[model samples]
Target: MISLTPLKMLVLLFSCVLSGALGGYYAASFSPVPAQIAIVDVQALVKKAVEKNQAQTEDDAKALMTKVKSSTEELIQRGVVILDAQSVLTAPEEAYVNIE
Candidate 1:
């Protein structure tokens, strides 16, 4: 059976812990990484935003088309509200009827 004396074992353990701590400190203090920096192209982003706005303006064209359709429906509903006062004519007393 082989055995190390108690005092020699303690000294070896202390030296190993001390060297490991010093190596970690030296590595952290002298790292060679570059610092962070940033740059942005403000004008190009603004131009892209203007283009997006121009594309979005086409929504107004669709809104106007819908408005025209809604107004046509309102006119048809108003025509239905008017009643026939005179009847027994060729078609109606006042309503315009196509003869053909």
Candidate 2:
């Protein structure tokens, strides 16, 4: 049998509202921005690399892999999310990037 006086009830309501406002502010402040996504045609990139470098020997393949890895890492460091072209069904033209 809890009996709340009007003043006590008002205080409780005020406390709840304050807590909710603070929580919302905290969440909004800490929320991450949506990442920009870029779709890459990995197969095309590989084909182009092979054609340019004549990737027949193991060393040539390794060099091609190194180049691809560096480029991907550079994009990631720039806060861009890279997705394989094949995995994406459809994307905006702006989402496609030429990594050549």
Candidate 3:
């Protein structure tokens, strides 16, 4: 077995520590970012759409629901937490975004 000098041992230890630190940094960089909280005024959106089209048919309602569902799903997939405007008593202005 080869005997390791003190200097050699120190260098090896330093390399190991450096590699571990770099690996951890890279891992952290690649990790997904935390989700953001967003507020959506579902009632307002529906109201606006309904107002635009005075004659609301069943098909139109179904289409609107489908659009909302798909949009919510997309936001959820991107790690966003959506809160209904009515449900949230208070939220930061920055948290509010147009879902349309």
Q: What are the models' TM-scores?
A: 0.38, 0.49, 0.55
Clashes of each: 0, 0, 0
Worst 10 residues of 3 by lDDT: 33-42
lDDT of each structure?
0.49, 0.82, 0.83
**Candidate 2: where is the Cα deviation over 4 Å?**
1-35, 52-55
Give the candidate number with the greatest TM-score: 3
Report the candidate with higher lDDT, 1 versus 2: 2
- Residue-wise C-alpha lDDT for candidate 2, range 64-87, written one tens digit per residue: 667766777877898888898999
Question: Tens digits of per-residue lDDT for model 3 on 1-100?
Answer: 9999999999999999999999999999999964487777878888998889888888987887777767778677888888888999998787776657
Which candidate number maximizes lDDT? 3
Candidate ranking (lDDT, best to worst): 3, 2, 1
Candidate 3 residue 19 C-alpha distance from true site, Å: 16
lDDT, candidate 1, 1-100, per-residue tens:
7687999899999999999999998998898743221122233433555576766455655654454445445445644332222332333223432111
Clashes, model 2: 0
Model 2: per-residue Cα lDDT at residue 30: 98
Is candidate 1 or 3 superior in TM-score?
A: 3
